[model samples]
Target: MTTTPAVRILAIGGSTRPQSSSELALNVAAMAAQAAGAEVISITGRALMFPIYDTETTHRDPLALDFVEKVRTAHGILIASPGYHGGISGMMKNALDYIEDLREHDPSYLDGRSVGCISVAYGWQATVSTLHQLRQVVHALRGWPTPLGGTVNASVTKFDADGSCQDTGAAEQLAIIGRQVVEFAQMRQASTDATAPSANSGS
Candidate 1:
């Protein structure tokens, strides 16, 4: 008999708005990942108030440390950021800067891990730029990016009064991204296990 390995997914966003589209998208994505049989943990930048990334302050902040560990240990990562100006938000960049800490200490943490990126922007133009920035960051971290990514443009309609999504189509797109991430992660995990030497192989 063989036991299946559980997939761990971490979803995060770059916005601190009270009812941000980025945050809402993360929640929707998490639901999709759960439906796809992956264990999902979602994190919002608004939940924590870690100061901007700085070497001198890391030791003083436990949340920052925890955030880095979550990213390091996750089997798959879903990152969403709002387009600020023409690129990724500064808050998202700040969080990303913290990833540099993992490069030397946890070199293999991101290797082969599945990654997905999403961008929610006020206009259609920002979607491409924001997602592109996220892709570049994930590549630098050495994670595999899923083929399908979620990109929501608000140029079509206003978000709900509560800042939630009113469009069923956008919601479904987010869900699709979640499912894709889990599937990719499972496939990669299987590939890894296949190549790994069994405990009884050399007996």
Candidate 2:
């Protein structure tokens, strides 16, 4: 008998502020992933605040260790970034840099995983710029970015305390991003299974 493992998704991003707009957006996307039948683990906001990543050593704070472990185990990822000066936020960048710790792992830094990118910024330019930068970073890490990335313009679109989006269209876009991550993850898993040697082969 063969049992398929549950898909585990790691949702990362947000600013230092608790319940920041980016974090709220992350939660919205994560809920969408849940609705897609994937189990989601969120590491956002203050939890993402880690010491600058140092390539010189492997020592990490407990939270940083937990963060890296989650990244190591996740089959998919959702990232919601708050644009900082037209690029990724310092804290979030530091958090991502920790993925380097998985350089020697079997998957080797998001290899064969799908990443859904979302950017929340006060303006359109920063939002789009951050989204592009984020996708580039994911590619550099060997992860596939989902086809539909989300850009939430904070000026026009608002997220409430309960993770509700003021704009219906934006909400649906975030949902699509979330679903795309799971969809791609399933595809990758299927491809891997198809290519693997069967149990009865060579018997």
Candidate 3:
């Protein structure tokens, strides 16, 4: 019997401060994706530090290049952001900007991938707004946003340093997103496989 490769998931987000609530939430979602049988690669916290995206510069930073490569190869993605003043944090936005490097890739910027979005904020307003923004960005990138995006109010749902969630309800939402991403990617892959001409068919 032949074995199929595990789905690759690129998990990115989190604040500059290590182990922040946003990162913890991302971890929860990533873990859930893993449980759903995906291989997750996470780029968070300080690892996300990159120069502000400059469309004029042809030169790419080494770290940014590696990030782009990961994005290029990922079959699915999870993006979590901390809502800052009713928007995504500058750092997180900057990292996302790096996706521009993938414009010429076969599928282009996040195209045909399932993206799971999570937004963490101190209040419902920021959480909802940030989640909406994430979905919009994903759409612009040509990625499909999972139906169940997570909106985590940092003031209400707290996380332990070990990446455990205090609120069961919020935790379930995060897990659901992760699972949805993997499931959608699998379905997309199946569809593609079905549509492709069979190797045995004449050219």
Could you say which candidate leads in TM-score?
Answer: 3
User: Best by lDDT, which number?
Assistant: 3
Counted clashes in each candidate structure: 0, 0, 0
Q: Evaluate all candidate structures by whole-model CA lDDT and list the values in order.
A: 0.80, 0.91, 0.93
Question: Whole-model lDDT for model 2 versus the true structure?
Answer: 0.91
Query: Model 1 compared with the native: what TM-score?
Result: 0.88
Error of 1 at 37 (Å): 0.4
User: Per-residue CA lDDT of candidate 3, range 97-138, in tens?
Assistant: 899888988999999999999999999999999999999999
On TM-score, who's better, 1 or 3? 3
Q: TM-scores, in order shown?
A: 0.88, 0.94, 0.96
Per-residue lDDT of candidate 2, residues 48-75 (tens digit): 8888998888778999999999999898
- Superpose all Cα atoms of candidate 1 onto the true structure and report the RMSD in Å to 1 decimal: 2.4
